[model samples]
Target: MKKIRYVFYMPVWRKGQWKDNFIGYGIAIWTFALNCWKPKMWKYIRKHFFSHVEMWFPDEDGKFITMTPEIDLEPFAINSVPQFTGQCFSSTMRDAQGVRFALASEVLRNPRRWWYIEATVTDTRYELMLLLAKRQEGKPYDKWGLFTGFFMLAPYLQNDDERYCSDVCAWLAWMANILPKRLWIISPRRFAWLLVKNLNRELKPLVKGKYNGKIQKHSRISRCVQIR
Candidate 1:
């Protein structure tokens, strides 16, 4: 079992042409999914410039692993399901520029300009265990939650039948007491910003240095969260 030290990966893209862009347009699609087609969400997406976010952890063998929900393409249907994948360092650009294998430590250095935040969750092993065990196959994607969330109509629309990337992360955060049970929920962008912001306020800065090259360990930050 892993101790649940986590890192987040966020991709950024440079502009050129439609076909040339992946991260940029990818964000558009994801943000639309997150916000339920809310026109105002575009402003927030543009403001943050983040398209996708994935959770990472170090395995027993010290290899970095990623857990995120992805669209499962089928013959006539598609769905989103949680998947465990290997570490990939690429911009998803036209040519997959700057792709490489990066360790959890090197992510903070951000050679590709990705964002990273670290925190230790109490009993993360148990949380991850529960997540894996409780995962049900054919769990429908919460596509309707998008519309409900966008219109601010009914928060009850989010069902237990499906799993979304941020929804799963947010649920774990709540279980760990890092977040509270309340009216407003969190999206991937919001969860990323909130968790990092909260940890920065509570923990001491452990490492800071100048930007070097790719795969270089730039900064290492640590903080402990008291799970209630």
Candidate 2:
């Protein structure tokens, strides 16, 4: 089996685009409000541009498989379940753009700074992640956890049946011994920061001028889709 690596999907906002949106405004407000007490947190918020993250593994067929939580309100859970059965580096959903496997590493091509991690994962660790994903399949998305995480100022909010995007990601990492602790009530952005800080100390920014040879070589998603 191909070694599994974690892929962090950043939100792609055009230049000068975020300044006009609610997300931009909200981030700004939070930065201003918590910068003093949470300087590290503020720095993390400022550094990350992408809004989402997911796990990827190479399947038995040699094709890469991606797993992430999809928001589903009807059953009030992360309904897509494992989200494990698809082409690697492909788009998560049909309508979304800039989300394909091609773009997974493609974001690094841009001039703006982005974060991506590639670690040599063991077969046991990979299977652990799969088991955790199986348990979380069809779980509810924890909207309240998202709110209370911030409100209560604790990531470890009440653990119930539901889970939000970051909550599940954080949980899986903790369970698999990837993340050090249960960083309860976390956001995707914060989770990204924590992963880099806690796990990989050698993490570096993807600068504009540098050639992306590492990604091209390591990101052997599949032969059917040429990376270039």
Candidate 3:
């Protein structure tokens, strides 16, 4: 059996330590339970441990860049793409166009808010994944689909038109041929569980630290930590 190797980093909030342990294409999981405002639907009701997930890759200059679909109300542009307004929420539903980019350093400013998981990918696949992710630079966030699909109310609502955090990551993996086929709709916690279950290996810290991170050995899911 091929073992998938991964390094789990503790929530130390040290930029220098994170910089020294950078992986060109690494996946980061954000635990919303850490937030002061709780996501009642995702956490308490649905029982999901993770709130969001994002992937990062190094640019030509070797600077890491993070990509994630979020509910941004700001106007932004990427490359030759015309400037576009981001997602907006009204009395009813949310508007489209929520893809956002940021320097890895900026996103990792509060390492305590996220759990870093570095997976091994081949050079060719890494390049392909980066290319595929860039193509979604201006995609919209699937606000409605997130809830509907999760509850199995409208599975057909799952499309490429818009994507949530985990949807984007799953789409990229499918597009890059890492996954056999697209996972239409998946929660961030469910996705992380799948990865950990399929990839047989012991979890260890990426950097030496006095603080230790723990993951449930039976379920392979990390306990959510409250930030405040």
Candidate 4:
């Protein structure tokens, strides 16, 4: 299957108001799932942002090099309503007055920033992606990354925000050698159990049932621990 990309930009409303675009929730979700799935999530993100952004390199010898391409955006359409919903009619406000939503061209430049953010989140800091996504569902990568990239770039908080997220965060804090308590690991084993559950969807269930319940079973048949 050829690799594809999708990006969904979900908006956040805090206290019933628009917050940061979709990056807020999308970041957290991607990161959490990646950390849960693979412990080396951060390493992957670090390589992408600081290192040269990669594109397919061509050589008869099968060597690949990275390249940067000029990707532009469609001009912002003014006097236009939101694509999916016209909710902006009421929320669109201007300085000293309530006006329609007509964003300037400079404001549209966030797309490039989004590209960097998405790439960074997916590269190594997948957990941060997950955390960001927890706030809203209509995120950028959630749609764009899915519709275009065909990857789960858009964060899905509902899917990964529960106990498993705590597990991923806790593990990240632990790896950083930060106190686990600050990361809320009073129930490390509890979060671990949830991690195993979410992981079951990706891989196979490392241990069945609840955390404590599966402890003995895991100990007895412990051979290849996938979520360790």
Candidate 5:
């Protein structure tokens, strides 16, 4: 059996149109900088975007994070796409179709900054993703998917704006809450579309730049997808 694990990170993507075609870099930049202060940064971020955050803590890896109780909602985009089978995500509901999921310890967002989830994962896809991020080996970004059973959060829609979070980031976060220890099954296709939706024009400006690249790659989802 072929085994491959994928890792992903954000604000990471293919080169876009402008020399600096960030959807909203200044905002995310400010937030990343402010995150240095923790309490004040958390307070300021919650004021505008989050409806309510559920958890916040520091991990063994020195990653301090806050968790938000994910709102129970399905993704709205796939509603109209018939090609997508019955589910908010085609990869999730189908059996034998391998989808990747990361265990989330927190939900952090800033209007002009970022929306992130930190988790542990195993049995993932898209090896190319990590090779590109240049993260440390054995770090969260270091492994790919497998039957070995590990989990971690990859990239997510950085925009948790009040109007969009429900459809964009909350469902995945909710999924993480439900299956905190199991492989959540990340789908490259699903996340690729996520990037498309977040970066496209006509959508309200959530951040500053277009995030690019594969969220995760599918090797042979046949083994994982169930015939439902």
Candidate 6:
């Protein structure tokens, strides 16, 4: 018999829950259920529950902030419509004006669409991963890499300069020695699944209402656990 460890899932909107619960470096995976354009495409193409991923870490002040590779079309397009022309840019999760102080506040606007898993790593590794992610800020989003790696089944086509959502997450895991370098090309859903599997825990939702999406058969979705 083996002992199982659990990774508790809680609502991101709940006040003080983030600071009280997640005190380590973690990764958050978002779903397309919110009617977002990019997420909808990811949901349709990947057919997975999670479409995008982002990394979160506490700043020097101990307030958590999210870092992700997003497609910003403002620089290249006339309208705000997102397209392949949008380059990948590393930035903190922010609003239209690009002001973001903490991850909890941002997710509070739509808590149901997000869930996070704390990575099990040493403090040294966490620092290294954070540094690696910071260096990726302002990098171009890998449009061709997304096409060839996921659609064309040729991950080697991906260049070192630009990266997609999951590519950046996978790269961080690889840099921290948590995952092998060979598994560089990965989908957001696949990466989350791997984390859950590696942690040997099931996702126990803390809030009520349905959150499960089109997950694979092997993926486990436990009943909601009320936090009193």
Of 2 and 6, the candidate ahead on lDDT is: 2
Candidates in order have lDDT scores of 0.44, 0.49, 0.44, 0.25, 0.25, 0.44
Q: Pick the candidate with the highest TM-score.
A: 2
Q: Please give, for residues 75-187, the per-residue lDDT of candidate 6 as tens digits.
A: 85332211111111122222311211133333322334455565567777866766676677666666566545334455567776777666777777777766655464565
lDDT of each residue in 1-228, candidate 1, tens digit only:
333433333454545655535544554465547655556445444455454343454454543433333333566544332222323222122232222234444444342434445555655654553454245323544555533555565467676565444565556556666566532445655665566555663211212344333331123221121111
Please, what are the lDDT tens digits per residue for candidate 5 over residues 76-127?
2322100101111111111212222222211112222233233332323122
Instruction: Give the Cα error of residue 87 in candidate 5, in Å.
Output: 12
lDDT of 3 by residue, 1-228 (tens): 111121122322335655423321122222332222434334321332345555655444433222323332456533221111111110111222366554444343333444434456677776676666667777777766665642555567667767677677766656655456776656555555545544443323222323234432221222232221
- TM-score of candidate 6 against the unseen true structure: 0.52
Greater-TM-score candidate between 3 and 6:
3
TM-score of each: 0.49, 0.56, 0.52, 0.19, 0.20, 0.52
Model 6 C-alpha lDDT versus the unseen true structure: 0.44
Give one digit per residue, the lDDT tens place, for model 2 in 33-65: 433366676666665554445555455664433
lDDT of 4 by residue, 24-63 (tens): 4444344444444444444433322210111111123321
Worst-scoring 10-residue span by lDDT in model 6: 80-89
| Ten contiguous residues with the weakest lDDT in model 5 | 81-90
Residue 165 in model 2: lDDT:
53
Error of 1 at 198 (Å): 2.6
> What TM-score number comes out for model 1?
0.49
Model 2 CA lDDT for position 153: 46
Off by over 4 Å in 2: 13-36, 61-114, 153-157, 201-228
Cα deviation at 59, candidate 3, in Å, is 4.8
